[model samples]
Structures are given as C-alpha cells and as structure tokens.
Target: MQDMLVRLLDLPDVSEEENKLFEKEGVVFKKPITPEKSIVVDWVGEHFSKNWADEALAAFASLPVNCFIAQREQEILGFACFESTAKNFFGPTGVLPHERGKGLGKILLIKSLRALKEMGYNYAVIGGVGPTSYYEKVVSAKIIEKSERGIYKNLLKHSK
Candidate 1:
C-alpha cells in the first residue's frame, strides 16, 4: 500500500490548478485498475457473497461498467461500479464495512460519477437500494419506475 501523497508526487505533468486540488484534497489519482489485483474484490466477496463477486467481475469485464478501487496505502478501503449503456443509466456502489462512515464512500461515488461523465454518461439511475436510505437522500438518486424489473438486469444496456 502506497500513501496517496507518494502516488501524487510520482505523477508527472500536473498543472498548477491540479496541484492545488491535490494539495487541498491531499491526493490525486487517475490510473486504471489492475485486473490482477484481487484483494479488494476478495474482501467484497468474502464479506458480501460469491454472487456479488461474480456480478462485480462480470461488470468489470463489460465495456460500459467499470470497477474502480481507491487505495491510499495499497489497502483498498472502498470501491465503486459505474456503468453505461450507450445512453444514460444508473450505477451501483459498495464500500467495505471497515471503511464506511468516513466519507470514503462519497469519494468513491464522486470518482465513479466523474468517470461516467468522462465516458459520456449523463443520467445515473439506481434501484433496489433501501427506499429510506442515505444513498437516495443525500446522493439525490430518485426512484423513477418500479414493476417487475429485477433491478440489476437493467444496469447496463446491451446493443442488440
């Protein structure tokens, strides 16, 4: 695990404004996730379930959904799974129990949304999340429609 400051210092061509953000946030990172790293996913599966692991891995392999983990000391405290479907769509996010309530989840969410925005995804829709939860309340996610939809099935749209 490398410190965020160490990683930030290793970066090159950082602009003055970017440097300020780094100074303010005390961190900066934009590197792609390494598929080989299994620690983060491993913890997720062990704590959540094997089903969650399989789903997360499949989503990572898919084009629209990207899995990202944040490591401040090589220890992934949290992660997010953002998706696209050739159109706007909602995404899913998960945080390790050991790292919750520290605002890390929010950071992970911000990173995921920023990545989606960069990928041209506009609207994000999330469902099946607890109806009365902090996610919907603080994150501004709204429940649009609900019927027989399995929820997860509609996360990423396929080009058929």
Candidate 2:
C-alpha cells in the first residue's frame, strides 16, 4: 500500500485574535449546518460554470458530512465540507472560492481524514480531482482510478 495518509490530524490551533474574530464576529471552526448559512458558502461553481454550485451542493448533501467555516469578523474566508461513504471511506471534499492555496485546505483535509479514520474507515478515495499529482505529494494520496474530461485529466484515489 502506498503510505498514503488516509488518517490524519489537521486541526490548527487558531491564533487568539483569529479565535476571537471568529467567535465574536464570525464562524471560526466546524459547526452544524443550516440552510440560512448556506448562502454564505461560496463555491467556485460560478467560475467553472453556473451548474457547478448545484452539483457541489448536491454532493455535499448526499453524504455523511461536517461543514467547516473560516471567517474573520463575519467575512467569510473559506470553508470545507467532508463526506463519508458506507465503508468508512471519505469521499468528496471541497473548499470554497477565495480559499484555495491557503493553509486552511490542508488543515481541513487532514482533519477530515482523521475523522473518517476514527469512524473506522481504513482508506479514503477522492474522485474528479484535478492535478492529482499535487495532492499526491501533499497528502500521500495514491491514484486508483483515472478518467478524461475533454482535454483535462481527472484522477481518483485510494489513500491509506
């Protein structure tokens, strides 16, 4: 098995100001979901295509999930949603627009992995991810499947 890190710990210790900013003004950590807050969730679907939003929302709703919101004083910085499959596997993971490349992605990804492992999943697989090689380096994800989307290549993974 590739030493793919399926089980991980990604909780970041928030700086006091960041904690206060989130606590008193906005959401800092993971919390329960409600439709009201859904409006605040920004997916880059508009960039990819208007339909991307619905697709992302649909996938998030279909699985066992926990949504994380990162805001600083009521301004939404980023968010990530995690979903688990029947075999204790974690499926689709997403980060909102304006949040890419920040340390938050890595944090949420690790935390989600850790949670799935705790739920008794031995591995986690992700499909429809672009630039699979990038994730492979950061999280030790091994590609188990691949597909083509026009000129783009999509990768699937089975992580340890």
Candidate 3:
C-alpha cells in the first residue's frame, strides 16, 4: 500500500460527530490512560492484528498516550494510534466491522491527525495506507507518489 499526506491545518471539527455518537449510540471517544493499556492492547490484538497491538504498545511510550479509542459502555468499538511506528504518522486505526458506517472511522482519523497538528506538525503521513479513497475524501489527503512501500519497506514478518 502507498502512503498519503494530510494537511492537518484543514482537519474538520469532529466534536459534533463525537457528541452525536454518544447521545445516539452511547459511544464515546477518548484517549486511553496507562491503567487501560493492557486491556486496550489485548483488545486490539484480538480484534485486529498482533502488529497493531505492538504499535499500540509503542503509542504508550509517549506522555498522555497517543492513542484514541471509541468505546460504548465497557467495550472498545474502535481505535486510532499515532506517533507510534513513526513520529507525525497517523495510522493503524480501525473500527469494529459491525460498528462501521457510522462515521466512527473518520472521527478517529481526524482526532488522531488533530493530535499531530497540536504537536506542531503541518502535515501528517497516513503511512502504508489501505483505503486511498477514504483518506482522500475524508481529509482531502494527497497520495505520496512512489511510496508504495513507504516506511514499512523494511517491515519484519513472521517466517512460515
């Protein structure tokens, strides 16, 4: 997959979406605290991939934690992690299959990109992008040409 670039300065406000999601669906978006680390990481592994769980672990290295989660009641609906695999990189985000189509993914993406902007970055890389059109339409992200492999060019894999 190729990488995409987003102008963090142009991120759309998602506060209303977040509030609506909670008011209507009981889903709340927030950053995870240290106490929730293991649960969050394990959830990511169970629902996504072990590599993503590892990236989620890296997110915990930063103060205040650089991970955002969508939760309803006590269950995690989705998550987005940044500054994990690399600084100023927005990615490794996903929503539960059943929870999609409710704009949760877009909300999570913007929330994470907004975090990067607050950190003084003008643009954020959606490294190893899988949904080119989604990123393009949601945030007006531009494709980074010749970045087919991008930062994951040297990504390690398990031996079969």
Candidate 4:
C-alpha cells in the first residue's frame, strides 16, 4: 500500500460527530493515562496484532502519550496513535470489527490528526494506508507518489 499525505489545516471539526457518538452510543474518546498503558497495548495485540501492540507501546513513551482511544466505560472500542512509527505520521489505528461503521474510526482519526496539527505539523502522512478512499474522503489525504516502499519497506516479518 502507498502512503497518503493530509493537509492538516484542511481537516474538518469533528466535535459534533464526537458528541453524537457519545450521546447515542455511549462511547467516549480519551487519551490513555500512564497507568493504563499495558492494558491498552495488550488490547491492541489481542484484537489486532503483536506489531501494532509494539507500536502502541512506543506511543506511551511520549510525555503526554501519542495514543488516543474510544471506549465505553471500561471496555476499549478502538484506538489511534501517531509519532510511533515516524514523526508527523498518523497511523496504527483500528476499531473492533463489530464496532466499525459507527464513526469511531473517523473520530479517532481526526483526534490524532488534530493532535499532529497542534504539534505544528502542516501536513501528516498516513503511512501504508489500508483505506485510501476513506482517508481522502475524511481528511482530503493525497497519495504520496513513490511511497510504496515507504518507511516499513524493510520491516521484518514474523516467523511462522
């Protein structure tokens, strides 16, 4: 997959979407605290992959933590993280299979992108995109040409 570039200044405000999700679905978005790092990372591993869990662990190393999560009370529904694989990069986000199509992915995405904007990035890369159209539709992300062999090109595959 190719990487996509997002113009941070062009992102839409998602406050209303967030409010609606909470009022209707009871899901709340939050940045996980230091004490909750292990729980969050483990959840990512169990639901996604060990690689994602590793990246989530890296997010915790930041002062305020570069990870954001969608949860309903004690259960985490989804997560998004940035600055874990590279600077000014947004990614490693995923929602539970059953919880998708509820706007949680989009909300988590915008929250992370907004965080990148706050950090002074005019543009952010959505590395190795899985849903190109989704990124384009949500954040006006454009494909970064010649980025097929982007940052993860040399990634080591897990042994079977």
Q: lDDT of all the models against the reference?
A: 0.49, 0.48, 0.92, 0.93
Could you tell me every candidate's TM-score relative to the true structure?
A: 0.61, 0.56, 0.96, 0.97
Give the worst 10-residue stretch by lDDT in candidate 1: 1-10
**Candidate 2: segments with Cα more than 4 A from true spot:** 1-27, 41-52, 55-65, 84-100, 146-160
State, as a TM-score between 0 and 1, how close model 3 is to the true structure: 0.96
Scored by TM-score, the top model is 4
**Per-residue lDDT value at 35 in model 1:** 53
Tens digits of per-residue lDDT for model 2, 30-135: 5435552455334424334333344336435643434454555555455444452223333344455565665555655655566666666666655446567756
Over 1-160, each residue of candidate 1 has an lDDT whose tens digit, in order, gives 0000011111223245445544654434332355533664576676665555555565556554476654554555556665532223333456667757656556556556566566665555443454435554445554544433544554553333
RMSD of model 3, in Å?
A: 1.2
Write model 4 residue lDDT over 1-160, tens digit each, in one string: 9999999997898899999989998999999999999999999999988888999999999979999999998999999999998999998999999999999999999999999999999999999997699998988899999999998898886554
Candidate 4: lDDT over CA atoms?
A: 0.93
Candidate 3 lDDT over residue span 1-160, tens digit each: 9999899987899899889999999998999999999999999988988889999999999988999999999999999999999989987998999999999999999999999999999999999987699988889999999999777998886443
Order of all candidates by lDDT, from best down to worst? 4, 3, 1, 2
Q: How many backbone clashes does candidate 4 have?
A: 0
Q: Root-mean-square deviation of each candidate, in angstroms? A: 10.7, 7.5, 1.2, 0.9
Query: What is the lDDT, from 0 to 100, of the residue 56 in candidate 1?
Result: 55
lDDT of 3: 0.92
